[model samples]
Target: MIRNTRSGWGSISRWFHWILAAAIIGMIGFGWWVNHVPARPDRFFYRSIHADIGYLVLLLMVLRLVWRAANPTPALPADSARWTRVAAGISHAALYLITILVAVLGWAHSGAHAPDYSSFFGWFHVPQFTTPDREAARAYEDRHILFAYVLLALIAVHVIAAAWHHYIRRDRVASRMVASDAGTSR
Candidate 1:
């Protein structure tokens, strides 16, 4: 099953979900590291790596959004309360929006800092969207860090919700993402 069904996620969706989740979480930690490390000659090297990952995340997020829009999303359990469904919807939307916003903010920051900051792993240069300006770069970086914390909080809630479904409700909601499509319908 390469595409999602009404009741469960397909392989592609699951892959995207897990891969993006890991990449986003890793990027957040890496960004923190880059900021906290002592200033050294190689500090830009670390920032470059972080910028590369941010570009990749932005690309993957766009692809994931397209895939999600084109596929069927698994429904919440019928027994779920209205509030649960609403919260899930809002959180999911926020996750997608904030992830994209963070990536864009990082890109803007890099663009404002220097043309070299937008290099995509040294393979090619991403066009700068903003002219080089130290103050603008600083502002962008601040907002980027703030939104990242918000993203982290949302991820925590997402994990807790999934755990609630799997452990407390003992339902298939969580397994719908992890389970094989052995007996599921397309």
Candidate 2:
């Protein structure tokens, strides 16, 4: 049987996916919440936590990519209209691009001058990955923020598509991506 994604997307992929979602959502909320706080020395604390989590997301994304390369998924539902398939492909591709873009910007922004903290989310120390400089940090920060907005919009579309498939299409379009028995009994 042809598999678009390895049966159930492989253990690593599932783990990476859930973990990445947690990290991204957590960082987004924390980052937004902290914006109202004063810029005291301790203000860096929240950011430190956000940075660490963001780094882990990057590493996991890389591993996920490697796994994707190793196991190519099957096409979307064959019964899906051609336009649906195209839209799905475009949305997924955009998700991937945004993932990379956000991770890189986040790393570069923090790497310039890491505060007195370590670990990509308190896990382990990540040595300053880039030279210390203000210009570099600013540029990286701008890109990171811009990409985050883009990512949020894309995620909105992704959720809508999944909802459409599950509630309206009444097909396995969404399940196939998340379930091992997706196309079974075909």
Candidate 3:
């Protein structure tokens, strides 16, 4: 279904969740790989791809936020514990906040470090908003790394919680956000 039911997520929501999850995870690995590459001409090409993907991620994040705001999420299972619901709410909020921050920091980091200009797939250019500064770039990069770790930890918790609900609680909490078999026909 296109709209969420009381028991599960809509297809749009499921697509957004999984797509963003994959993009973010891939960007994390790409970011690390680019940093480790030897100083070669091809490294710049890889960095350009990273920057393009970062911009795409930012766009997706914005779209996801709008989608989330416009749509209703499935309600927690009726039998869920109060603490479980509360934790879910907080963790979800944190995930949103951190995702936004990570994207912004990446953009800012690029602006702060770019020697000449930032290009998006060579079709367009993203202006560097901040003046290039070695120190500031270092600081932004450090925070980006730190928050990335935090995001990773939150993802682990999210996955574990979903597994707990699915396997231990035998509830729809996990499936609702997954493929959405109408919120859990199981």
Candidate 4:
């Protein structure tokens, strides 16, 4: 009833978004940085870190979905064209689903052997989902990379859409999702 227009994003979405952003960005950076190191141990360390970030991203994605389901999103911009809204809806869904699948596939690639069901710390163990096979690892690992490319494409589309709405359209489409509810423009 008392929605403030310019306050802040909803707590659940805000936390979900920022944390997932940090993890994915960090994973991307670490992935780029990994090749520079030659030592096997160092490589493993980088891999482990990247994988950890992936796990965090996947976990957050699940939580975000649940939150979205329970709370529902604010309405789309009143003036947004039907096709534009549909494209945005589809692209956003693809981003969430593909990103989670990519991470899960990668984790399965690495952890199928149980690998001690490891985490970065002794913090906790994520159960190994299946048994190991070198061939299976290679296949799923390649698929995971392909999934990454697809995710990147989807992200590009999302970014372009956000920019189009914010700049060209002078709309609050992206702002409502990213902003704390400064006011209930939605």
Candidate 5:
């Protein structure tokens, strides 16, 4: 199905979910590597790539939010506990909010650095919202790192919850995202 039904996610939603999940996870690891690399000419190359990806992530996330708002989300299992449903809602919100915050923080950090690296793949210059200051850059970088860790923790919890639904509850909650919804009725 191209559009989601009450019973399960559609192809578009699943694609967005999986693609964002992979991109966000990969970005986290790549960002870590970029931070750890020694100062070298090629380090700027890696930083530029990371900045470009961060821009793309920010754009994709906005589109995903729009898509989500316009679409029908699959309902949770009827037997799910009230707390489980509440937790699911809160976690999903945090995921979206934190993802956006991290991207913005990275952008701000890049802009504030003495040697700005906020260009979009060298295609065009991204406007720096703040004056280039080493101290400000460091502060933004620190918050970026802290929130990134929070995002990572949230992802771990999300994965565990999905596993619990799939294994312990033996419900179709997890499969609703991974499997085709063609056979599912509204």
Candidate 6:
């Protein structure tokens, strides 16, 4: 089914979930690698790839938001603690917020660097919000890194929480979002 019910998320939502998960993980890795590479040619190549993927991720995030608004999320497990439920809701919201913030800040950080550093895979140019300024770029870059770390921490918590539900609680909380072909119980 394309639409979610109270029991589990639909295939569309699952696709969005998994794709965004993979993209975010990849972007994080690329972010780390691009910063560490010393060779200008290698770094430029990595940065170009990273920029394109980041743009795709931003688009996917937007589509995911629209998809979420149009679909229903699974209900919380009946036996789940109230605090756990509250934390899950807050963390999920924070994940969405942080993802958007990081993308925007990264875009600005790239744009604020000298000579208009950002482009959509080098096929076209992306406009900058700020003029070239080293200090401003540094600030944006710092915040982007900080937000990326926050995103990573949240992801770790999210994974742990899902594992807790799957193993300790023996619940379908995590299964609801996984592929149906994976034998996820409804």
TM-score of each: 0.95, 0.82, 0.92, 0.85, 0.94, 0.91
Model 2 residue-pair collision total: 7
Q: Taking the tens digit of each residue's C-alpha lDDT, what string does model 1 give over 1-186?
A: 889887888898899999999999999999999999999999999999999999989999999999999998888877779999999999999999999999999999998986458778879988878889999999999999999999999999999998998788877687777865532432
Model 6, residue pairs in steric clash: none
For all candidates, the clash counts are 0, 7, 0, 18, 0, 0
CA RMSD of all predictions? 2.0, 3.1, 1.7, 3.2, 1.9, 2.0
Worst 10 residues of 5 by lDDT: 177-186
Kindly list the per-residue Cα lDDT of model 6 for residues 22-61, writing each as its tens digit. Answer: 9999899889889888878567667667767777788889
Highest-scoring model, lDDT: 1
Q: Write the per-residue lDDT of candidate 2 for residues 1-186, one digit (tens) a residue.
A: 222353344445556667777777677667667666877887787788777777778888888777777776556655778998789889878987898889777877887653433455555777666777878787888788888878888988988997998788777666655655664423
Least accurate 10 contiguous residues by lDDT in model 1: 177-186
Encode model 5's per-residue lDDT on 148-185: one tens digit a residue: 99999999999999899878887878888888753243
Query: What ranking emerges by lDDT with the best candidate at the front?
Result: 1, 5, 6, 3, 2, 4
lDDT of candidate 3 over 71-106, digit per residue (tens): 887888777789988999999999888978887787
The sequence of per-residue lDDT tens digits that candidate 4 reaches over residues 1-186 is: 222232335766776777876777666567657745776756676677677777778888998888777664666667778998788788878888898888888888877533522575457767777577777777777787788778777877878887987788876766766666532453
Compared to the true structure, candidate 2 yields what TM-score?
0.82
Q: Assess each prediction's global lDDT (C-alpha) against the native.
A: 0.89, 0.72, 0.82, 0.71, 0.88, 0.83
Q: Which parts of model 1 are misplaced by more than 4 Å?
A: 182-186
Deviation in Å, model 2, residue 117 alpha carbon: 6.2
Give model 4's clash tally.
Answer: 18
Model 6 lDDT vs. the true structure?
A: 0.83
Where does candidate 2 clash, by residue pair? Answer: 3-74, 4-73, 4-74, 5-73, 52-120, 52-121, 119-124
Q: Ten residues in a row with the worst lDDT in model 3?
A: 177-186
Error of 4 at 84 (Å): 0.8
Best by TM-score: 1
